[model samples]
Target: MLFSEAQEAFKKHLIYREMSGETVKGYMKDLRCFNRYMTDVYNGAIYVEDITTDDIEEYMHYLLDERELAPRSRNRYLFSLRSFLNYAVKKQWVEHNVASEVDPVKVMEEKKVALTEEEIDELLATIKHKIVKFSVAFLYYTGMRVNEAHNITFEDIDNERNRLLVNGKGKKQRYIPIAKSLKPHLENYLTNIRGPIDSPYLLATKKTGRLSAGYINYELHRATKELGWDKNVTCHALRRSFATNLLRKRVDVFKISKLLGHSSIKTTTVYLQLNENELQTDIDKL
Candidate 1:
């Protein structure tokens, strides 16, 4: 089948598997880029039968050399293409799963960047925009992922119980406790700043409905750049900083895991590694 034909089949498979819209879009974009590369660079049209392991290798190089994509991003594009090829193989559209035969790219282990307490304070203090400051503070205190923070609604806040109902990854529902220290700020952001009960979201654009994850990330990025921070700060970094700081404060790992709404304690174990130096110091004292 032609590249377009293969793409349509992949889209059908994604839809059948109930993949999210964003996921589907990413897969489609990656595959199309591959198709374009074949046509433009090699002057060769790609068919399901024409796809080879060599082509897959060349595509990886193209992503790095031509597209200048980061290792992590290149891996994600490779993953999307591999999934499509796997689907095509199962459907008998391709002779073999060329992606499986291709050697996988090695992803380097990068250290997690957690903000120090002083740095965190500086970042917070640097935020002159009240709304943005509170948003950052909420993430710092709640240890919520960017998407989770954006998912917050007025109704989600259980003031009496001091908890937040969050729809987390995989559409899983969990309750995250709000620190007593954050209650006043949360109330102020809601009543004074957020304004209007027409929308269910705690944070909404004046013209639109709920704030998107992209919007939150963009604001954080702009603020971080303006502050001249050496390290690239992201919205998710706030969540990581919260977890790392809590671990530094000697908070129970299990409790921290629950507050972060991590399905497994293993997911929260990265913070333990972050504290390895401190952990060794404590051990030496003992």
Candidate 2:
């Protein structure tokens, strides 16, 4: 089959499988780019069944060496190709999964970035806008993901219990204990700024609808840029900062994992990088 024909088939399969629109678009775009590269570089057509292990390796090299794509991006391309080839093999279009033979690009793990206490204070103080300021403070204190923070509602705020029920990843429900320190601020925001919204979503847009994650991110980026923070500060960074600070304060990792609604403690381990003393103590015990 022609490359375009194969592309349409893959797209249809993704749609049938109920993949997100963004995911479908990304896979199609990556595959199309690969097909174009094959035609331009090798002066040959690449049918779905005609893709080989060598072709995949060459494409990876082209992306890394020629295009200088980051390891994460290179891995994403590999993943897209791999999924396509697996589908083709299942349909008996290809004799084997060529992508399986091509090794995935290795991504080097970097230390998770967290804000120092001073930096967090600086960030909070720098936000001149009342709404933005409280939003940042809420993120820091609650350790909520940007999406979860945006979705919080007055109903979710159990003031009597001092805990908030959050709908998290995979639609899992978990209760996060709100710090008593933030109760006053939360009450103030609800009473003054977010008055009588029909929508249960706590953080509403200016017109009193649920806020989009993009808007929250844009505001955060604007604030961080204005403050000239040397480090990269994304909305998710607040979540990481919360986790790291808890670990630094000797908070139980298992408890942190549970609070974060992580299915495995292993996922939380990444955030708990040991200090030199901890590492040395472990080594000395051996």
Candidate 3:
């Protein structure tokens, strides 16, 4: 089968397997770039059977030398191609997945940035957009992924119970405890900012009805730039802050793991990026 035909089949396979829309989009984008490289450099349409391991390696070189993509970004491209080739193999279009033979770029482990409470307060104050403010605050207090937050509806929020029913990854449902400080933030947004919207989503705007991850990131970037902050302050940063703050408060790692809805406690530990002073203070105590 042609690589293009196989790419379409892989896309449908991804969707049918219930992958997130963003995940599918990312995979398709990487595959399309690979397809373009084949057409432009290899001089024509390439069949899945004709693809070689060398072709995949040369593509990686193009991404590194020509496109100047970072190791992490280049790895994403390689992974997408590897996944597509795997799909092609399953469909019997190819004898094997040649993309897998290519070694991925080595990425150094960069520590995640977790916002301090003061920094969180300052960022929130700098954000003039009401929905964006609420969204950031919600992530901080609840430790929810921006996508999980986007999925929230009125029915999911239980004011009386003081918890939220989060539809998490893999369609798993988990209830996140609503912090007392966050109660007012939620109440105010629902009562004022999101007042009587036709959409059922908790973070509805009059223009788009429901908020998108793109808009949230764009607004967040703008706010961070305005504050003259040079760090990578993202939606996931808020969630990391939640985990680290909980750890500082002497919360059990197991409990924090559950709160973050991580399948493993090891994953939660990665988010606990305490500052140097905090590390010193804890060491002194010991």
Cα RMSD, model 2: 4.4
Ranked candidates (TM-score, high to low): 3, 1, 2
Give lDDT tens digits, candidate 2, residues 1-286. 7777878998999988876566788999999889999898768876777777888899999998999999989989999999998888888888888898888878897655678667788887777767766787788788887777887877888878889998876567899998876777787887787667677777775675777667666777777898887666767777788887788777999989988778899987765655577669768988
lDDT of 3 at 84: 89
TM-score of each: 0.84, 0.73, 0.91
Per-residue alpha-carbon lDDT of candidate 3 for residues 108-202, written as tens digits (9 for 90 to 100): 98878888889999999999989889999998999999889998998998878888999877667899989998989988987888777799888
Q: How far is candidate 1 from the true structure (C-alpha RMSD, Å)?
A: 2.9
Best model number under lDDT: 3
Residue 190 CA displacement from its true place in model 1, Å = 1.6
Error of model 3, residue 278, in angstroms: 1.8
lDDT of 2: 0.80
Top model number, TM-score = 3
RMSD of each: 2.9, 4.4, 2.0
Candidate 1 weakest lDDT stretch, 10 residues: 270-279
